[model samples]
Target: MTTDARALVPLPRSGPATAAGTRFRLHRAGIQNVWQYDEQEFAFGDGRLLLRGKNGAGKSKALEMLLPYLLDGDSRALDATGTGRTTLAWLMLDGFEQTNRLGYLWVEFRGTTDGGDHRHLTLGAAIRASRSTQKALPTFFVTPLRVGEDLHLVEGGKPLPVDRLKEIVGSDNITDRAVMHRSRVAPELFGITDATRYRNLTQLLHRLRRPTVGDRIEHGGLASLLSETLPGLDEDVVEKVARNLHDLDAVRDELGRLERTDTALRTFLTSYRGYLSGVLRTSAQAVSRELEVLAQRRRAAGDAAQRTSELRTQEEESEARLETLREEEEAARTDLAALHDSHAYRSLHELSEHRSTVEAVHTAAGAAFTALSNAHGAEEGAAERLADGVEHLGSRLAELGTEHRELLTQAEMAGLPTGHLGEAVALPRTVRSQTVETQLTAPDGETHTVQQRSVVRVDTATVQDGLGSWQLRPGHALPDGPTLASALRPAPQPGCGVTAEQVERLLTTIALAPAAETAAHDAVYHDGSWRLGILSGRHHKADA
Candidate 1:
């Protein structure tokens, strides 16, 4: 038996109290009209009892009539010796002169019920044996009738018949059925309600009964008796086990097959995923190249448009100035016609001729000063041109290296197998990119916004000494450049269609002033640098 999954030792006082606080102590046990004696009885000491007798003195006979036979009504296990020699028929018929016999075996238990009340329960068997029939018929009973006090199994020296016992104990208290007698003893006499546990208790009691007590004390000792008495599993119970062991083996075989299938699939997918990635990466690189080419065309178109817009503005300005000069000329001609007919004009003619000569001299002096300033500016412009050329050379070197790397990458990617591109060669992925807005002053002095956009790039490289395998490599991104937007914005605008790359070439023409502290109209800043245009005092940042 177990409680909370822990095994219980069959030790005394290990369990809780029984119902009604009852304890059924064997008060007396006896038999009559069945064996050597016409009537016999024994009393127990404090519920513990022992029998003592010489060989052939009917002690074994007395035990055979009362024991498990009375408890279970089983005549086969009556001997207590594990021997089948002693039986109900032999006990009732042996040493008897009478052709027919009627007998009884009984046990009385005295105990207390709830509230300290006295109680007595009697378990008994009535036996009838006939010489003519060569058989013993038994009827069992369990009742609250106290033996020797208010109930008796015998009267007039012969055991009472079943009718006389039933009349005394009542039909409800007596049963001819062995099963009913056994069922009542556990609950009514011993206060044990659980049928299975009661059955086990009785079985253990039967197994532990000692038959060789005399021999054990004289020869074997207590240790030997206990060692020999401990029970082991029955052969029949052990045989039924392992009947389903073969079914478990079949399930294990199925699991082993599935594990092998899983391993094979994992191996194939590892190689296939690499091959697929390589093919996809090659396609992406080709698309990037095409995009770069298209971008260059767009930049060229934009530059052309800028130049055309600037030329149109210049033409319009020239026409307006020419119109103003023509209007001034017509007014001068009308004034001259008036002067020809006036005396006042004739008087100032000589004075006007002298004033014109003075103005001519002033104009010549101013022209010489202008030529001197132009020569000085030309010398400074030559030095600036040299610095500009050096910067351009450095930029060209970087661009050339980039171009070389791109060409090498293109050649390598071209070797990949992309013949089945449309047939699921590509893997779709959600691409995340960064796009920031920045201000750019175009070559024609037009200010506009452009997006500086970039995304992470994935590349596939062939593994060394491998069979059709490629490894993935991710490209690191460059850091963002310095801000060039004015205080009015302080940051780049977003969602502008113009890309930095498109106007980058024109932006490079405006030299950046490295020494300038901040942006102003005279020291303009654009595209990540400050720009003080070629020895300029003041330069227009932009108009609207």
Candidate 2:
């Protein structure tokens, strides 16, 4: 008959006790060892189990054998004190020198289903130790058992043969079946399927065995434990909260950096504002100076406009004067035309041209008349002397004739020379005398008488009166005679109605008319001359 170890001491369940949930009650654990525990059973209580033994009594070895089954083959739980090895085979003690020994451990559990049915299970593993190799070797027979099953059990204190164990659990299953079987049983026994939660629970249990500050329980450890041990807490929510806290810290750091950048930007704007203010002030002053200059220019322009107005007024006055001058010029030209048509001017020109001819004719006529008069005087004197001589001769001849008559009477009486005397001669028949008469004719067919007795005389008053009618002076009168001079000279200054002075004035005005018109822009003609105005800014004679 088998003995139950739960009656000695019981361990409290870490979670719910149900077949589907991860909770179980450990009823007992037993170990059989060649060097230490020949056959030992440890019972669990509500909270703890105590095993009091001497040195080399397999106290730690018992825990090592139980750890592979409890924590699903987490070898870290089987670490020896000084061996530096962590395998359950290594954790098993070697037999005395030159001795072979067999070792095994078994743990039994009871679980309750949700339907209130209870199930009993037994987990077992076998190991072999060789003194020569000093190594413990695990058998693959890690089997699950019911309370009444009789497999790999012997009646006496002799060990189960390796062949019989291999017959029960095949050699091909030896590599990892013991550990894999524990992992499969752990979820059902503890209501924890996640490897991380299972690891935490095992660490919690180990830390509870030896308490330290480094092994203190944190919220994560508590959360993991509660997620498996308690009925209502969710593990995913706890993990999500932890991740959200990390993201929040990163965002807070980014926000701090942004605040510092914003402060720098504000400082830059302040400096820029001051600089812009200075620039604007300078620009405004420059604009003000320019405005003042423009104002001065505007005043000067007004003065210039006034001057222009005065100039325009002067221009208008000059234009009026020029118009009057143009009329005067036209009148002068008309007068000049009339003067050209005047008979007085024409007669003056003719008389001037013929003055030499008239003088020449008068001089020649005077000379000829003078010579004829001198010759006539000489002829008259000679005729008188001749007459005197002829008279004296006649008297003498008469006297002589009387004497001769007496002498002839005597001679006739003598009759000697009377025939040669031939009667008394009568002064040789008296030389014959003839008188020549001359006449002078004028251009009018009137004749003047000139008689010469060896001399001639001319009538000057008649010639003078005759030719005096041809004079062409301004106040000379026409001749009242039928002569060539009367025919040649018309009424003195004929055909000219104006006085000489007026004609001369008109001619002068015509000669200066063009110059007056050119300079008339700034001057005026008054009376008989050009007079410039001061407002026109120029002074010039119309005739200049």
Candidate 2: lDDT of 504? Answer: 37
> By how many angstroms RMSD does model 2 differ from the true structure?
42.6
lDDT tens digits by residue: candidate 2, 1-544: 1222232333444665333342467666777663355566666653246665555545655676675434454445555343446564444443244367676666777666677876666666666776667666655333445422655445366766767765665564333444565555556566667765666666555544432323435434655554554345478988998898889978899989999998998999899989988998999899899999998988889888998999999999999999999999999999988988999879987997798788787777666556545544554554555445445544544554564465455434332234423344234332222455668674445687755333111122332232232222344422333342344335435543433343334334334433433332122122012111211111121112
Give Cα-based local distance difference scores for all models.
Answer: 0.59, 0.53
Cα deviation at 50, candidate 2, in Å, is: 3.4
lDDT by residue for model 1 (1-544), tens? 1011111111234345445346778778876666665666677655655655446566556666777667777777777787787777887787776798888889887888678887877888888899888788888887878777788766776578789998888888777777677788777765678776666666655665656666766785756554454445678776666665657788799889999999998999899999989998998899899899989988989998999999999999989989988998998899889888789888788779978987786676466445534533553464345345434433543453354344333323333222211111111122334556667554344665644333222111111111011111233221122232122123223443333442232123212311111221111112112112422321221111
Instruction: Estimate the overall C-alpha local distance difference test score of candidate 1.
Output: 0.59
Clashes of 2: 25
